[model samples]
Target: MAAIQWTDVAQRLKWEATPEGYDRIRTVWLKHCDTELRQDMEGLLSTLTDDCVYTVLRTTATGATRQRWDGQEGARAFYTALFQAFPDQNWQPEAVVMGPQGVFSAVVLNARQVAPWAGIAPTGQTVSIRMFVYFIWAPDKGKFGGEVVYIAPIAE
Candidate 1:
């Protein structure tokens, strides 16, 4: 899989945000996404608060799996594992809603299964998974405090 085409995603995405919050989250989230695609760990961490929490929910045929990482250290560990598993991770967001509290996005996350992921064995095939992700925004701090991703893999 290739890196995300930010221009393409931006052109097609439908977005909305409160008058007061739009500018804040739009910049933060876009930078976060950009750094993520570049696989820049430090840049990625810069976009998040020091006390940030990251959570993932992967739904498979059998059941759903949940994982959570708290604080900067945990975030670093999570990203390290993620980059190792899927270096070319990408996402195409269809819609986004932002408010004073947080931002929610509906998107398709694409990545190659180069290693075991969410308990599934490696297939070395690109997979497009529908995901609803929520990003907690700390307006005062001007950074993301947390992120929650709910991934629903396509049924085979």
Candidate 2:
């Protein structure tokens, strides 16, 4: 493993130094994104390691909300809740970076509130939000070991 240079900025990942490294990261990232887009839970689960950790952080004008999910069962519950809240969701990647540690993506999410989200009742309104997601790669398992998400609604 090469020395990884990490930064707190969203554009931190930088694994373009080698073809094999780039391909490896890109493949896992694309598959993860594709599965999420398709709402294919099983497919997404396949890309994760058994002890994967998933977290979500949402910040609003009022305050911030954070949640975590551990392992396979937790991941399933997290996705289920997300789909229930935003039945129609789409992710448009604004930027993506690949590094020795993981893949980082900044995305714009367009979604419809069809059900309650974080205790807020459904208003059947369309919303656009900015989200930063990181998928940590586990070389030994050749899969993603963890994922972290940060989201904030885009003010109109």
Per-prediction TM-score, please? 0.80, 0.82
TM-score of 1: 0.80
Error of 1 at 134 (Å): 0.2
lDDT of 2: 0.77
What would you estimate as the lDDT of candidate 1? Answer: 0.77
Error of 2 at 47 (Å): 0.3
The residue-by-residue lDDT of candidate 2 on 1-156, one tens digit each, is 112235533334333346777677788878987898789999989888898888877777888887788898988888898788898887778998887668888988778888865444677897777889878787667788778888767766
RMSD of 1: 9.0
How would you encode candidate 1's per-residue C-alpha lDDT over 29-116 as one tens digit per residue?
8898888889989999998888888888887768888888888887898888878777788878889887665678998868896877
- Stretches of candidate 2 exceeding 4 Å from the true structure: 1-17, 118-121
- Quote the positional error of residue 65 for candidate 2 in Å: 1.6
| Candidate 1 ranges beyond 4 A from true positions | 1-20
